[model samples]
Target: MHVVQAALVAFGVVFVAELGDKTQLLALGFGARHSLRRVALGLTLGYGAAGLIAVVVGAVLGAAFPQRPIEIVGGLVFIAFAVLSLRRDDDEEDDDHSGLSVGRLAMSSVIASIALTILIAEMGDKTQIATAALAARSNPVGTWIGATLGEVSSGMVGAAAGSVVGDRIPPSVLRWLSAALFALFGVSMLLGFP
Candidate 1:
């Protein structure tokens, strides 16, 4: 695929994956308590760092393995992601920030805290894994850029809309949509559709 096409595909995949995710909820919570600018900046930094790591590892793995085998594995991984997405509980509580007091932190501290929290929370998250898988099959640089942008954009939606977003869009709907997309991608890859 062309680099731009890869990036666009990655963006769509990651963006849909992030909708109704816990990290987006975190962004909503922080947005309710802090400035949107800070929340956005923090999310951008954290997602960028995580995306960089994912793509680099994926690039290395892609280079190390034969292309056909890698595509097959990537397809399986995407199918697994679809199953996992369906299995996620939509009613799960967002209690990750129970201990932190955002009011007491300075501006820079708030940004750092948010960034660190996201980085830690997303280290092994499905989005990161999906990003890695995408990089393994597509253009690593494109995947990195698109995944990072997708993550940031979804986070920004939560931050901008706050709790209103939660009230409007059902998490289950997003989950089902995301699962379908993953399944489609997996099936396409497995069948060598592209």
Candidate 2:
């Protein structure tokens, strides 16, 4: 695939994967309670690290699987992500910590907390897995860059919205949009968009 196409595909898929995700909600909460810049920076760094690792693994896997099969698998994975996103349970307890202060705002505690929380929350996440799959089928560098940007953008948007709007958007809308995007990508990839 072309580098631009690879990057675009990874960006779109990963962006959609992040909507209404647990990490996004965390970013929202962090934004409400802490500095948005620190939260965004931490999210960017953590997501970049995750994207790098996932892309590396995908590149390794690419060496093992041929292009055609990898593309097919990536498509299937997108579809599965769509289903999972639509079916996700939203009844989980909120872990809001607005009452707890981790020290002065100038300290690195905020960054550390956001980074650690995101890193742990993103383990085996759909976006990470999708980044790996995209790398396997396309350019690993493009996939990594795109996925990293997508994750950062998602975090920033979520944080900004959450801080300003306080989750006024309905979760169902995000789910439907995510599902549609995943299905569209999956179908196009399966049918060979190129």
Candidate 3:
């Protein structure tokens, strides 16, 4: 089915986008202090909620606009984001969460803290934007499911191997890969490829 295919494509794109991203890094840091299960659950729930909102927004936009124009705009947005990612400095990528004081909140309950943290962190994130864009281009439900799962998967991996993976792999490589994938999809959309 087309839905299945769309889900798979969304999954791959979101998975690649999440790797070495700030969300994953946050998961890794949280996992170090809190229980892995808690971190995973928090991330899953947070991302799920975020994905749902993104899908709804995208679906609304998709319904309002013609397919070709929507696709063209989505493609352009992806391309623009790709360029932004390519130009982003490594140090500048670190999200400054110092003022938030998640640590104090974590003292009460790790799960709640993590959930809140992820919900806040994920707001306006690149992965969220990508999910919204994917929804606009494909099946909204499928895109939401795939993107949420992709985020959860990345969270799990980061929880388990954050230190190792983050240290071993350079962030630049992930940025480049994400940029390339976004560019490819953007070009495909512009070319009117299904």
- lDDT by residue (tens digit), candidate 1, 120-186: 4465567888999988888888888899999999998988876454456666765676567667756
Give the Cα-based TM-score of candidate 2 against the true structure: 0.60
Candidate that scores best on lDDT: 1
Q: Tell how far residue 18 is off in model 3, in angstroms.
A: 0.8
**Which lDDT tens digits does candidate 3 get at residues 1-194?**
26777788778998899998766766775554445656777888888887887777744644566767755765676577557547644322222432455643433355665665566455556787788888877888788888998888988888787445545556676557556755765676577664
Off by over 4 Å in 3: 58-108, 162-194
The lowest-lDDT stretch of 10 consecutive residues in candidate 2 is 89-98
lDDT of 3: 0.68
Q: Which residue pairs of candidate 1 clash?
A: none
Instruction: Give lDDT: candidate 1, residue 143.
Output: 87
Give the clash count for each candidate: 0, 0, 0
What residue runs in model 1 are displaced by over 4 Å at the alpha carbon? 58-105, 163-194
Task: Please identify which of the two predictions, 2 or 3, would achieve the higher TM-score against the true structure.
Answer: 2
- Residue 56 Cα positional deviation in candidate 2, in Å, after optimal superposition: 1.2
The sequence of per-residue lDDT tens digits that candidate 2 reaches over residues 85-120 is 476433222223333343333335557656755664
Which runs in model 2 stand beyond 4 Å of their true positions?
Answer: 58-106, 165-194
